[model samples]
Target: MPTGLALRDPRQQLFDAAERVLVRDGPTGLTSRAVTTEAGVAKGVLHRYFADFDAFLTGLVLDRIARVKAQATALGETAGTGTVADNLTSALMTSFDPVMVSIVALIIARDELRTRLRTAGTARFPLVGEGSAMIAGYLTAERELGRIAPDADIDTVAPTLIGAAHLLFTERKDSPPEPEAVRKVVTTVLAGAMR
Candidate 1:
């Protein structure tokens, strides 16, 4: 594939390198040297794309946030025939990537950076919001089909379901929760809450 000077924006290179380093070695491995080496760029090149370490870190978080939101938004926008659990499952599952979790952890730890990110509006991509919206959509469909309870308030319920998913995905252990365990938590919560 065509890359390097063929790519006009060096920022994309930094982002791509950041993604790889983050997935492979987690957030602590995201150094300018590491990213530059991964991108095959001179160490100084990282500065041209990013103002500093903090800026690059902010961008890293924002990039993952955008991806998660995009995934949830696309799933929400799609017109699919399935049970409420299925649609909710699709959106909730996307939130499990290590990339997003690592970003969230860094943002939470760096209050100054997190503050700048919030003020810069990089922290408001609505990742969880998108998942909630997807759940709301599914619940609406279920209600229309009389499969979900008429009294159910999707706006409230969706976030509750997403919150559970967040906790399950955030588990830090030598052995992370299995896919089946995560699915069970999501499905059980949705089943009880939907109808």
Candidate 2:
């Protein structure tokens, strides 16, 4: 960008650019220079907004966590209204979508970023942990409504679903797994839980 040029929302611009770099290059290709270049801003701009690259990454993952929390609220609203399998499938598809899957990979690859995230007060593995919470919350609501067995261990089931969805998305690479594939995993995982 031109020197002294103004951006309406530099943070969001940088974030969106970071996501694009992550998608195209995977974790190895992500760097402060890459993000700034992708954002069309000076490298100094990133430092201005964040303490370091890890801080910037923390911002990105935390932003995503907020999105997952919002998704959780929306998923909670659907608890008793849809088939449990269908609701879970929908949640998995959106919760672990392409960008999110990549973000998870990015998080796993950066030790410093992980430490920084913890320092920033997000000790959980951001995307995966938050996504699991979303699933668990929905399942808990379902159980309360008698849609699922009262004995269902949602804490275990939630992370299992997130892991399976992450695997499907990661292995598929070129495309997202079909809804049927996700549905099958959901139904299978929850078979003992669904009443």
Candidate 3:
């Protein structure tokens, strides 16, 4: 019998390395060589796992989306355990991390990669849409717990918060917003909805 979990997933390791390269060097620096070097694997490792660089890029974006979605789900799980502002701020911060920002930049700058992502059935890259839904779900749970106004329009509030945070993260590419700034945005967006 194997002791603990002996087998490791190479794909996850590669994805982590790719993320490091992306955060440190931006989209332009995310070549196969760079990814492999960062991962401590041969250049052929990525190609073996993915069809090509475009495939790898798409996989990375999708992986990140899934991760954010999982986090959103967890937020719903603990709806009433923490302050609404704190919870919202944590969710927004996770979405706007440096690696995620770099991936967004990569998708925008590389037309080929974008085409590949579209072909993968993410034409609009529904990260924001999915995130909005998660936020709405969390808000609904909070409202049920008497944490928010009974009449709060959750649908509208969710998108407003997501859109503002997305814009703030994208616009401030060089200087990511501070925690206070994110908190301010969260507070502002939640004012009408929160009790």
Candidate 4:
């Protein structure tokens, strides 16, 4: 059966296949062959798009980072539209999703991949930092609308929320945190900060 991936942009198809391999088989299971097989493309297809496996891995990480950043950037558009906690939970969900967690774990565990990423000038994935800044910006906007306490330390609150979400997602390996739990985390964090 044709996977139809061959019809998509080769790079994106390879990226999607890499993600599926990473999620289902973990980092050790990810290989050029694996991605090509999953993508249902010729084994040589990935090599044609990327220099090597490391390059592909770095590209995948960077692409995911870009997506996270975009999500964070769009979060500001939700300002004042819903309960602060609800809005925040929705935004943070992307960071803690199963795919993201697997990617983070893979990047951290592989020295070669990490070195390649760092050499590419992305030593650290900036998703958390960027997300914190975006959240802080959103909080500031909310404060202007009187939704948050005027004296709330948005800088601190933003990183705190990110950290809490990271912990919740990373620690609960067997059973992912539920949406309500995510909401609760956001609510508890904002209780003193929101008006």
Find the candidate with the highest TM-score and give its number: 2
Between candidates 2 and 3, the one scoring higher on TM-score is 2
After TM-score superposition, the amount by which residue 168's alpha carbon in candidate 2 deviates from its true location, in angstroms, is 0.9
lDDT value, candidate 4, whole model: 0.82
Model 3 spans with C-alpha error above 4 angstroms = 1-7, 118-123, 170-176
Which candidate leads in lDDT?
2
Sorting all predicted structures by lDDT, with the top scorer first, yields 2, 3, 4, 1
lDDT of 4 by residue, 1-195 (tens): 343443658889889998899888988898889998998888777788888888898899889878876876688788879888888998888567777878887877788887887777662554456567768888998999899999998988999998898889988867778889988989989988988
TM-score of each: 0.75, 0.96, 0.83, 0.84
Taking the tens digit of each residue's C-alpha lDDT, what string does model 2 give over 1-195?
Answer: 565989899999999999999999999998999999999999999999999888899999999888999999999999889698998899888887778988999999999888877777773886788888899999999999999899999989999988888888899888898999999999999988988
CA deviation > 4 Å runs, candidate 2: none
Worst ten in a row by lDDT for model 1: 122-131
Q: Relative to the unseen true structure, what is the C-alpha lDDT of residue 131 in candidate 1, on a scale of 0 to 100?
A: 53
- Steric clash pairs (candidate 4): none
Clashes of each: 0, 0, 0, 0
TM-score of 3: 0.83
lDDT (Cα, tens digit) per residue for candidate 3, span 12-53? 988999999998898888898898788777777778789988
CA lDDT of each candidate? 0.67, 0.89, 0.83, 0.82
Query: What order do you get sorting by TM-score, best first?
Result: 2, 4, 3, 1
